[model samples]
Target chain A: MPQKNTLIYSNWWKYAGAALVLYSLIGGLLFVNPNNLLFLDETVRNLNYHVPMWFAMISLLCISVANSIMYLKTFNPKFDIIASKSAEVAVFFGIMGLATGSFWAKFSWGTWWTTDYKLNGAAIGELIYFAYLILRNSVEEQNKKARLSAVYSIFAFPLFIVFIIVLPKLASNSMHPGSGDTVGFNKYPLNNNLRMTFYPAILGWIAISWWITTLLIRIENLKSIENTDEN
Target chain B: MLLGLVSHNMFAQTTENPFYSNGKIYVVVAVISIIFTGIIIFLIRIDRKLKKTEKEINKKNQHKD
Candidate 1:
């Protein structure tokens, strides 16, 4: 278990996160967009809810990969548990990003799914992580599973970055903003008014996600501790 | 026919659907609701697991006593 003094065990950040999210929820809807977005209309407010999911996913997965590296160096089962739990939360956020993105696309792009580079790239990236989970389940030995999945995660992170972040930028005709010829939403659609909520929304979402990850980590730690006691 | 009604609802983006009305403010409400619901469900699952863990701990303590 993380010591009581440790930041993860601290309760302040969770409350702060909840407060910021509440502020964003009210501010996101109440704040008027200074610019009229073509094809987005009122759905422009989805920026506060949808965009944050990807940010939180990337942050959590980065933590997961970092823990995997730590596991490799120290051979600590704790690090392996943290890495897997982080990946689990990251995958959940990724799915939420996809679902919300699909809904947003249906309104703006006139389709639920699209052939856009970013869309396809995100889908493929999600599948790779799903495969990682399946690979872990396939191995029975604890140490071997940890070692193998740690190595896999080390490799998977780079591939995930390439698919979800890099390839889209390289694709010339990609419809996603910030990829290809299109500028990000920050360039035109997001005015100072929207930024007020957008930045906090991202921070709040990341904090909330980390809160959940820590809870899962504590649960896993408790389970292991109990098993050790039994034996 | 029911098929025609379903197709019209899907293809026509019917305003009769409550979410499409009132300048579509309800869409924002729907998005917010979905996010909140997802978070609550996650917390509920965690709560159940924690409860089970607590019960096990209590049983172990009783056995020790």
Candidate 2:
């Protein structure tokens, strides 16, 4: 068995995550929306759910890349396990974000998907991480796989940033907020009630992602132990 | 004074949405709540399965020892 001190997990944040998300769910639906917004209507409530998924995705990807860097520096398999699991959770959130955004757009923009820069950027960013998963699977040796993927993650993360953040701003016809003529959340501005719920929703999602990743890492550790025993 | 301010504000803002007034918004809320509940339950199930697997592995290790 591994040392007890080595395996540090906290239950407090897990409960907090669940509670915050519950609060957000209740507050997000019932809270008073600011009156008279063009196109968005009642669907502006999606901001509490959809926007936060992207925030959680970005946060997870940052953790993934940070772990990748740590793996390179320390050559620890544990860090690589975490890095890979974080990316997996990030991809899960990215897909959720895309689905939610597409649903929102269908109502607001009158289409499921757009040819806009932000949409394409988000698609490409998701594709890059998907390709990272494929790269991991293709490698035969574990150490070589970890090393190569860590390098790829470190390099690709900046390009991913450019796709989602930088490119949208540069493009003229982008429909997402803070780009072109589009008014963002700032222009409409979340009321005090919405802000209270929204911030907690982001925290809740990040905590949930962390919980899932830790569970995955623990499973992998158990599998490794089983493999070593068989050998 | 606070009661006067509250009454004044209530009269001042006459925002109208048919869905909210008719209680249809609660339907939407119910649907969202169900979806969120389902996802959380699924996560909890997965966590339980992992815990079971860990326990089985620990048992096997103890048997080997």
Candidate 3:
């Protein structure tokens, strides 16, 4: 029903995403880790599953905020729908990322939750978006709801970036990778084995995120159509 | 004796992979299963939503008629 030519709505991408994710799931299990790093050991395979989740979450959040900005500029209700639904999917993936990370951490760090900067930052970012959802539901008027949430989304995104990306790097003795004094995963470049699985997983997750958001948009459209029919 | 032979063959096959020695392969299986389960649940939720929407629209059409 959209007049615009957006790549997100395409069926081919959905198929491709499903295929890539299936491939990654199989590969992540079968492909042998080259170095077999310590502490991580066999759980290093979780990198394909756990890390791509954060990548998908960030990508969805980026799409959500971009649509929010577009809504502000054009004031289109459709953009509002896209923005909100994308954020909803983003939150879903973020929670999954946290849960998987916690599971991984329990084995790797010997704790389910840590006071690490990155962990706390990710928690705060998730809370900020949860607040954004609460703020949206509080308003009844359509335009006002969209405008306020759009503004809030734009404001929160930069804080999210700072929390998840910047603050972790600044703190010393943080538990996560790429933090101060820690080499992180980047210490060893992903060899062909890891790269083959990793890249496909990222694409698959992003595609799945897009597929879910579009389904949500379609549902919203149906509701709106029903409302108009009643009128 | 037959049961023991089957169990021994299973164990031998599993032990063939060096990665299986650490019991880490099960972790990989668990993670993949969790992801697949999550996706299945999501699909079911969407299907439920679509069915509800269809019923509502059909009821509205009947009322109009």
The candidate that achieves the highest TM-score relative to the unseen native structure: 2
The runs of at least 3 residues in candidate 3 whose Cα sits more than 4 Å from the true structure, single-residue gaps closed, are A1-8, A189-192, B1-17, B21-65
Looking at chain B only, the TM-scores across the models are 0.62, 0.68, 0.80
Give lDDT tens digits, candidate 1, residues A139-206. 99999999999999999999999999899999888778888777788788444267767888899899
Task: Kindly report which residue pairs in candidate 2 clash with one another.
Answer: none
Estimate every model's Cα lDDT from 0 to 1: 0.81, 0.81, 0.81
Ranking of candidates on DockQ, top first = 2, 3, 1
Candidate 2 regions exceeding 4 Å error are: A3-8, A189-193, B1-15, B55-65
Model 2, B1-65: lDDT tens per residue?
Answer: 95574434333333455545566667877887788788878877887787788778888888888
Work out the TM-score per prediction.
0.80, 0.86, 0.80
lDDT (C-alpha) at residue B64 in model 2: 84
- Per-candidate DockQ values are 0.07, 0.35, 0.14
Residues A1-231 of candidate 2 have per-residue lDDT tens digits of 643323225467877887788778876766635456566667766767898888888988998999999999999887898899889989999999999999888888899999988888999999999999999999999999999999999998999999998888888777887665665776764442457568899999888878887788888888788778989
Shift of residue A217 alpha carbon in model 1, Å: 1.0
